[model samples]
Target: MMEKMNQDGALETEKSLKRNNVVRERRISGAVAPGAGAVFRSVHAMQSTLALGSSFESDHIWKLGCLDGSSPDTGKGKSQFKSSSITNKVCHGFHLVEGQSGHDMEDYHVAEYRKTKAHVLGLFAIFDGHLGDRVPTYLKDNLFNNILEEPSFWEDPKTAIKNAYRSTDKLILEKSMQLGPGGSTAVTAIVIDGKDLWVANVGDSRAVICRGGVADQLTVDHEPHSERRRIEKQGGFVTTLPGDVPRVNGQLAVARAFGDENLKAHLSSEPDVRQIRIDSSTQFVILASDGLWKVMNNQEAVDMVKHIKDPQAAAKRLTTEALARKSKDDISCIVIRFG
Candidate 1:
């Protein structure tokens, strides 16, 4: 297995290196604005050649929204993750673009309250939970803030990301004891210094970039099978089954995530992170639950919204397309456009 990984590692590593960073799920509790009801809370950051509300006119992708899904109750929702986006102007014309979860609302919000910077970072995530709801809710509230708040982020991003992933997973596992049997699969994107986008994922939630009519994947879906292949070659059988149903070990469907105390050895809950540099050729980005990607190919999605003039419209269409394909999982998408 080590030999297989070494041979493919270059490819995987290159892919990982070309696009990599850190991002996840949590609990929430607190008072939100009066008009917001049953609405999941989201967070995002951005860097641009233009200012907010300004008619964007340039070659840079604008960091737009982060979209995510959560169940009102902690136990019955999708894996929670962050979905960040951007858009490309292409040949001519303007494009429309746009852009949460919760529980432990207070801690998450308080942490969010600390990131008072003025960048427009978006949140599009799906919190898929098993055993309980508390952990997802906690992620809905805090993970984003934690990623940025870490001291090592600016100096050693990969290290910072690894640390954050493990730390968050540990915290979720610990809290779940009191909160519920909660553990969550997540995908998150954060715009750093405005020039880069970071995606961190555990499980199957996916992040994809549309460039030149090709769906450029920004992150990989960690699964027991992927892990299994790696481990099996190393003289290991971490999971009882393979192929038909993917699991971190033999227990969960997600490859990385928060909580899952019992599945720790088989499933580390650590995330794979990547950083993306957006340019004019970059059309848009999508972040969604497994339900969406399970049914659609990356390039297919890019083609769906490629020439469309409005990102929000494209996002809606993309989600609709997935549903039309009979995707039974919850679907959420965030679309962003660059002028």
Candidate 2:
């Protein structure tokens, strides 16, 4: 496996380098207000020039109307839940432009049933992919399912989530040939018992909760500079480019992610988990790729969506705002509102 990885490492590193450049540009450009609705024409053109592979169409792949907390199985792409135990609204949106590959991945499973247990839960996640779409796509399909299958998920969720993350990373490494050399940052939110929320993350994808109209970050970003100690201890180095941000190994910007077999020795898939008890103060939660985060802070995002009423519109506004600010990465987001 090491030998095979060595052969592909060079090519993968080159791809990661390009993606890093895009991220660096976003950082260098300060945050643009949500009202600024002008798309950075040059940035989009640059992204198109660097984009590899076939382009995907931007049709409404799936849509669900206002579901009044009746069904748990409302197909894919959208769902809403409201009951005595929980009152929540969920909405997801994505972007796929011409001449560019849509690499970001997202998934939300509402009222997911347990095989042995009789519990129903909701799972929401956003994955930011670099190099290729394989890693994020795989995570969108498997990560939540794997966490549910951990058996101990109901009793000790933290342990279950941690184990699932490591096991899933192993699976990605073992299947690298089919999954490719790409990697992805992930942020996942699990709502159980209808009143509690558990969030986990790896890399820069983020989860933020709006409590009393104030934004509270649920997960910490795993960037190269933030995890310098861990990286150096693992015999890996983080490098900073002039006028740019720090990157892991001078290649990948994120310090932790799923896949990236060549950097697995230094990188970690172990997620930071946080548990929250929903109350009157908790307005809504936003799980999004870095594209939205690159241009908006926690308060700005919450402020933009607090009065929107519709979760889908809130998510779309966030993504659209990011693009307007010249964000070059694939943007995706999931919004969940609680009563």
Candidate 3:
């Protein structure tokens, strides 16, 4: 069963898993203030229910918020929610701030929970776009759905995530005419029954988990300089000019990303996938775009918010710190606390 609250604040229920793919766009005209996006919360308990579309549903409460390019707010917002399982309590919060780049916010995120027949899935991701927000927006709506649709998701999650990322990149390339000549870096995490976590990434967006008070990075940052051989083998060159990071073919900065029709031949969208069993030593997980990582190290971030019990406040603190450090890129962050 699926329940969706539309823009009019009306709840609509669907009995089946089959649903239309509708892209909802909200246009904002002025600078958006901090925490100025659509915020909603849903609560559910453990039950033997079918998976409802891509939205969150279960016995636990989850909060989600996304800001597309339409918001006029100086590109800042926050949202958070908490949920519990028989073994652990899960709570998540996200914060976003548009950079001083003089452009609309080009970062998007997803943080919610869903119930399958036998498990509760915590789905979270960060998509950071360059050139345009279209690719990231598209990812926000479709990437996780495609990953879950893979036949091997349950038995071979690593392969399933890789296949889904490749296929999704193909779709984005095919739709580049509409999505624009841009691309997005993605980092995704799937937590099963609040215990098993599967993380995958393409490009720089990163995922870090805190275990026993130490920060363990779960995602790889696919940088052009680090993967120069791969790019050169594909007839692409990595360029390093003064005052600029290495770039593929002197164009894109990352070696892997979704979309980028013009650079498709040089870039790869294959994600590095990793899986870990969540246990007692696990404290929390952090997912954020390069904006935050550019200013803070994994340990610094983990330490800054480890003492903050509220996940939402923790997320905000990270973004606020990044801004204080003079990070000039759009910043997006998610904090998932496990206890």
Candidate 4:
């Protein structure tokens, strides 16, 4: 249910020279492009399905860095953040690869709450884009801030998140002229007061938690096959062609996402939200794009990172494993570990 192309999809538009230049021009002059380090080793031909025993090493290990007010336009590289105040007891890391695409549409954000009334909140998210990176970049810059700005965020996180998703998507649609014809899937995790965890997702990007060595998926993958009834009721039909996967209206693979302006009538931007009470049994959470989940199951991914102490290393390891397993899509991941 990840981003895939069909007969009428935007595959060609995604790879057009214009869009590629847009992505490149937005990146900082010296920002590292995808595949920067030993991070991207050659894919093995053994048909390894889960990357169970594979590993990767990189100097991109976790460390404490400045959480300046500046937002790093990490379009196609790696980033990690940890702190003693905002994210007091948590460790985290993230890695991104453009894969075979002309440009990477993936972006992430880790927002540190400062002077917040709620229990020391922190926000983390992964935005997997299709058609263009503008939507994801917009999400990286605005989604969480908009959510936190909601007056009801502290009193009613659920309704706040839902409203935020709708309003944010509306903003994206309103700015379609500037954002271009791209769209994006999102998985957002909000750690409230450090004891409550809230997650919301649209499309296939996902969030999973590791509790006492077991994997529990926090978000559902909204695939066209599962939502065919609703799409049909909305006057849209899911189509499946020989050798090609089923797509919504014979175009988009995901049933929901942000900013598919052309297909907004058929696609839904509302997210499936879940709340979990964090306890001693909770260990860490993984937020990733479909690139990793397409090749590995939740349990497999949790098992791979359960023993890793450094969250940054764990994120890099997960990205490396996906590449080794022959995943041919843009890969990105965020590992958040609680101590």
How far in Å is the alpha carbon of 141 misplaced in model 3? 0.5
The list of candidate 2 runs beyond 4 A from truth reads 1-116
Q: Which one is best on lDDT?
A: 3
Give the Cα lDDT of each candidate. Answer: 0.50, 0.62, 0.71, 0.68
Models ranked on lDDT: 3, 4, 2, 1
Which structure is stronger by TM-score: 2 or 4?
4
Q: For each candidate, what TM-score against the reference? A: 0.62, 0.73, 0.77, 0.76
Which of the predicted structures, 2 or 3, would earn the higher TM-score when compared with the native?
Answer: 3
Looking at model 4, which ten-residue stretch has the lowest summed lDDT? 39-48
lDDT of 1 by residue, 135-251 (tens): 656777767667767898767767777787777777776775565554667777664423466777777777888777788787778766767765455443545454546544445
Model 3, 11-115: lDDT tens per residue? 122122232321121111111122232222221111112232454422221222333332222122222223344356566766666565544457788765666
Q: Which 10-residue window of candidate 1 scores lowest in summed lDDT? A: 1-10
Candidate 2, residue 285: how far the Cα is off, in Å = 0.4
For model 1, the superposed segments whose C-alpha errors exceed 4 Å read 1-124, 229-243
